[model samples]
Target: MTVTVADCERVQTSWFQLRSQVLGSGSWEDDGLTWANGDLMFPRVIDPAALARGVERARSEGASIVGAWLGLDVDPRPLAAAGFKKGWAPWWMAGPIDLGLPADPRVELRKDAPGADGRPPRAWFAAARQGGQAAGGAWAHLVDDLAGVFDVEVPEPFQRRGLGTGLMQAVCAAAASAGARQVVLNSTPAGYALYRRCGLQRIGTGITWWLHLPS
Candidate 1:
């Protein structure tokens, strides 16, 4: 199945909502913008009007810094007019899980189990271990048939050792095991090639806007 940019955005929003719930933060929508307050304040905007409202809301909430995810179709002139600067541009990627990718023998994959309290897990985490030490990790949130992958990281010391591919493969395996039809993630420049090797394609480019509000 082909995933469009809209699908990618919806999956991204779902990931943010799941993160907010897990962190005990708040997520809401107002004036066509989706807002989330967590380690960082994020307002997903679709247009200039919503962008303006998000800026005001962030400032009123005393947010020292606000980040906005804008689809590539969004006009940048408005963001510049509002004093928001361009942040990193990440590719929105989605694809079927390539279970054929070979997992690194040195990296053992672990998935989070249900807590002792027995509350069903809202999100699944996949961590890669090398010689019983933490090598890399990532999180996957399932919303219906779509799974959103977040924070796929491999430390500098762990780089160039295929830990990232192992993590991606592990994530895909977990998502597939949980019945997800597709996996999606925003890929940074550094991780772009790895994700491609894992079978994801760049469906769209997403813009992240940043603004520092007065204290």
Candidate 2:
């Protein structure tokens, strides 16, 4: 079968539409967060100009900017031109429910929470011991299917280690196990190539348009 650009756009559009239905409407939200399927109208990181417009629009409609989103468009140029922040303000990775796979050697994969089997894990990790002395190794979490990813820190001293890959691998593996027909993520410029390495195809891209409260 073949797919067209319009098909892709529909998929993108519907994804956000679904998010809005399940979570909350992308209308004027007095609380500061609005949703449209998976497309976040408001997320965490705010874009000053567009955000101002968004807030105005929301306020005019009796809503407020409770949250903000950073746009992730297919064209990085537009985002750059808009001076939008490039990061995971929303969008996250998801896949098959129970990808019962091991967490490759030199790392360990385990359930993120106790009896989290049916609850859908927000995140998982492939951890390495902190040198028989320190605290946490490295970790990443699934912020649910609505938001793609939150953050991953390997620690300053832990840089250069292959730990990040292992952790991601483990997470993907679990997502696969969880019955996720596809693994999804709005990868950063740095991790974009890595997502390819891990077997995820670009399904759709989103833009975060936002307005923030004054500091």
Candidate 3:
């Protein structure tokens, strides 16, 4: 199964839920914090006033907007012209097989077997030994249609090892177990080819937008 344009709205909404609950708390719950992980962290229905207020709170508390991401359905130029810089434009891709091993994923990290109900739990794998120590890992999530990834860096000295591939396989297996259709992520140029080699493709471009608060 592939992700469609209609999925954009859902993806954006889901991102909000994740950013909210994961970073701190959300408006959905009454007990959320006064200082929130606002629209800046991820693509959100931007309310300028709410955002300004949030930023002020963060600054007063000695916090800053670390990063921002949002999935788009229309051309991103309009957004960029509005005062945001292009961070990344990754394709949201999907594959036919969600479970089972890829043709040759190589090496094992930790395997989270699929749940009894026919869903695989999220998993990760890595390989890149120091003196035979693992260097890097790749992983994915299984949150409904919002399934996605996590990437980690291997210490500089451990570069060029296949730890990255192992993590890719780990997430794929987990997605398969979870019965999810697609996995999405924001990619930098360096890893684009590796993802393609792993059977992941670019479907739609994702962009991040930011506006400097008038200081």
Give lDDT per model, in order.
0.74, 0.44, 0.53
Root-mean-square deviation per candidate: 3.4, 8.4, 5.8
lDDT for 133 (candidate 2): 35
lDDT of 2 by residue, 91-162 (tens): 333333233444646566666663436666544555654566332243333322322322444566755566
Per-residue C-alpha lDDT of model 3 across residues 4-120, encoded as one tens digit per residue: 634543544455564565566432322221223454433335544544455555455444442345556434453454455666565555444343345334444565456669854
> Which stretch of 10 consecutive residues in model 1 shows the poorest summed lDDT?
37-46
Better of 1 and 3 by lDDT: 1
- Measured against the true structure, the TM-scores of the candidates, in listed sequence, are 0.82, 0.47, 0.64
Instruction: For candidate 2, give the lDDT of residue 119.
Output: 67
Q: Which window of 10 residues has the lowest lDDT sum in candidate 2?
A: 141-150
Arranged by lDDT with the best first, the candidates are 1, 3, 2
Q: What is the lDDT of residue 137 in candidate 2?
A: 41
